[model samples]
Target: MYGYIKGVVKKVYPSHVIVENNGIGYLIISPNPYEYKLDDEAIFYTYLHVREDVFSLYGFKSEKILNLFLKLISVSGIGPKSALGIVAFDDTDRIVQAIELGDVKYLTKFPGVGTKSAQQIILDLKGKLIDDEVEIKLISDAGKDVEAALVSLGYNKADIKRVMKHINVDQSADQALKEALAYLLK
Candidate 1:
């Protein structure tokens, strides 16, 4: 339910930061946790995540990053940890680029993400991100139109989907489709 947290940094650790708002302390996990400083006032765009067994706060340096994290988590098979890993070393542009280019190798470099999980991320989030502040260029003209074309040409959607899952956002739709098709045929 919380949106953002503005407070003084009480303590900074290698993986988490403690922010003091009023008299309470919030332990926030961040991709680059050490980017914050102790005693410095800062604003963290936060997401309060609660499950059956745990409650935690995940913070981001910018609203764009926070929104990206939320979008990543919405994907099926993607959890908060996976989303955090995607955004930890990669930014919004990098993710979009990975999807557009169908770069499974690059995406798999992130912690906890494997070939299947990476494909799932593309299936769920491809062309679904809201373009507000982040400038994500659509590499495809018709948004998965190429995949549809491949399907119409007798290829199975599931196979095409699997192929497209590795593409990055920086590559054009035509490029991704061609690459995905090649991967599938190989």
Candidate 2:
């Protein structure tokens, strides 16, 4: 029910952070908790998870990433931990790339993912992400071309725009387009 939390960081560990809002300290689990520092004023996109025996807060730096995490956890075989691992290692683009490429090997590298889960991720999430929202770090030559080809192939302009945004100019346009399309399609 919480939209976001603004607070001073009380402590930071490798996998968790404590943020003080008002007089209370909230222990939040995150993919890269170490990226934050003590005493810093920070805003965390939060997910409050309540179960019979546990209540936990999972936090992320951006709302986009947090939405992706929520989507990941909705898959049948994926859990919060697996979703966090995916976010930890892959940005929005890369995860979409892995899904578009049907590269189970790359996906399985994340903690707690295996062959079955990887396949499930691909099956469940393919074509489900908003093309404009996928974020990736590296755009290969192949990726560029694919994106352009998709535009030429009669895909939606918004789709092309979103895909193009993630492409790195250093990559050949054709290849970057391809990778972008892969992410977009995913």
Candidate 3:
């Protein structure tokens, strides 16, 4: 029922943070607890996960990531920790792209996702997570082509993602690849 919490960070831990709002402290499990600082004012978009005897409050820095986590947990073989590990290690855009493109190898790179789980993620989420028009317009097909080309050249996802931030999505794949290579070589 907690949509979000605006509070001062009271404590920071490896897997969670304690946010004190009003007079109570909330134990908020986060994918990246290091993102928060002690005593910093922050807003955490939250998800309350309730199971048989455990109640957990999972938190995300952004609503988009929170939504993606929700979608992940909906898959039969995926659970909260698996979903957290996925989002914690990869870019959300890349995750969506892998799902849409049915790239099982990329999905399996996540901590808890195996071959079967990766396939299930594609089966359950491809063509369903993002609208085609938004996907094409925002992260243009050309951009993805450039990313695939870079991956083929033995570059890691983190480096490719770093260069991608400098790429102009509107450009042709050839042009984008040239720009990305220039950035990578520097």
Candidate 4:
């Protein structure tokens, strides 16, 4: 039960990082491995997943992400990998609010989460998440749909996010799309 590890980063893969401590290198999977650089010192909160065939260690940049990952894996259909995906969703407060509010549509935006799994997430974790009161300004179903549409039309999500800051109040997915594109092109 490795609760945490502090070491110098040896190598960083897209999905994992190798940290060296006490003459040994430990490979730890992280949601965003690029956050840790080679030869940099870091303390990663960790969880060890044990199974019949394999054992793996997952590291998180923060306790909130680690806790969220644990909660995600507790769901019936979610494994550690899927849970990691959910944790990688980038906004812990928004995700917790979505689950607390039973927003399946929002959950589906996470990688590896489908409709059935989204609903299962709502059923299994509703009211169990920490209510962090993060102003979830526009992560609604409509907002996510619009974002997806923009991505399909060749806009990157990060660029869309920058443009979205100029969008006005909530609108239907279609209306949001038009407004978003208008702002983006400007």
Candidate 5:
């Protein structure tokens, strides 16, 4: 039931960050740990996923992302990893919009989400965000090429997601490719 943790980042892995607080390091699984740097003091709005044998902490840099993750995990078939992957790939706002619009096709594009699950997401979450006043701003089509380029370069979707914050989808596909490559290589 811990709500948040403000600590210094001790390390950043591909899927999680180690945050140190009160001489204890908390391994918080995050969608994009690369957004944080070592030794930087920051606050993580968090959710602790607890089950019979599995206990893990998931943290987000922003409340919007945290809330979105919570909503995704609440769906019947979606787990924390699936929910994290969806948001990690920049599909939060898009998922919200798809659910709102009853766009099952768009919902199925997310990893681990099949037709049945997409329908469930739409059924469970549609009209949910409207009451919360969450805005939906999906990225442009250029993201496909950028994602493809990263995949072609042997970077998995999870790894590519860490660099997405630096990309601007307003540019052409080629530009997004180059920008994403530059960031990934660095």
Candidate 6:
């Protein structure tokens, strides 16, 4: 029944973080727990997975990632751990693109996903996962340059995609790059 948690990260483990809120520490499993540094105050969009033997909370920095994780676990044969593993190691856009494009090979590269599971994911989610707000488009020449610059500076495509939506495509490459760097650094 818990939705999101706002707290300071008390501990960061390889697979999960402990977030302390209202004097209670919550064990929240996450894809990249290291993304949360100790003592960082933040909000985590959460998913509570309940089973006969387990009661667990999975958290993500963004609601988009939380939604993706929910969709993944909805597919037959995919569980919370497998879905977490997929999102943990890959970019969100890349995973959506793979499903939309029916790239079973790309899906299979994730841990716990084999050929059959990949096909099932494509079959179930191919046309359903494209976010209404974020549509992937072909980047302009200037956009490509800006993306490359961001990649070189250690930003991933998922982060680039999130920031690129706010960039002006008509701007000059240098201007666009400058704008992208500013948005990304924020």
Q: Which tens-of-lDDT digit does each residue in 19-138 have in candidate 5?
A: 999999999998888989899997999999899998999999788889988998898999998888888877456667667557788777778989998898878876575432322233
Query: Worst ten-residue run, lDDT, model 4?
Result: 130-139
Between prediction 1 and prediction 2, which has the larger lDDT?
2
List ranges where model 6 is wrong by over 4 Å. 133-186
lDDT for each candidate structure: 0.78, 0.80, 0.87, 0.82, 0.80, 0.87
Q: Sum up the clashes in candidate 4.
A: 0
True-structure RMSD, every candidate: 7.8, 6.2, 10.6, 11.4, 14.7, 11.5
| TM-score of each candidate structure, all chains considered together | 0.71, 0.74, 0.73, 0.70, 0.68, 0.72
* Alpha-carbon runs more than 4 Å astray in model 5: 132-186
Quality of model 6 by C-alpha lDDT: 0.87
Candidate 5 has its poorest 10 consecutive residues by lDDT at: 130-139
Question: How far in Å is the alpha carbon of 23 misplaced in model 1?
Answer: 1.6
Candidate 4 residue lDDT tens string, 1-186: 998999999999989999998998999999989888889999899999999998899999888889988998999989999989888766787887777556788889888999999999988886566433523343668877877788899987567766554554257888888899888887
| Per-residue alpha-carbon lDDT of candidate 1 for residues 40-71, written as tens digits (9 for 90 to 100) | 99999999999999998999989989988998
Candidate 1 overall lDDT versus native: 0.78
Q: Evaluate candidate 3 by giving its C-alpha RMSD to the native, one decimal.
A: 10.6
lDDT of 3 by residue, 1-186 (tens): 999999999999999999999999999999999989999999999999999999999999999899999999999999999999999998888899888667799999999999999999989986567743452323678888988898899998667766765666568889989988998898
Query: Could you tell me how far off, in angstroms, the CA of residue 57 lies in candidate 5 after the best superposition?
Result: 0.5
- Candidate 5 lDDT for residue 27: 95
Candidate 2 local lDDT, residue 125: 79
Q: Which stretches of candidate 2 lie over 4 Å from their true place?
A: 132-186
TM-score of 4: 0.70
Q: Give residue 118's lDDT in candidate 5 (0 to 100).
A: 85
Task: Tell me the lDDT of candidate 4.
Answer: 0.82
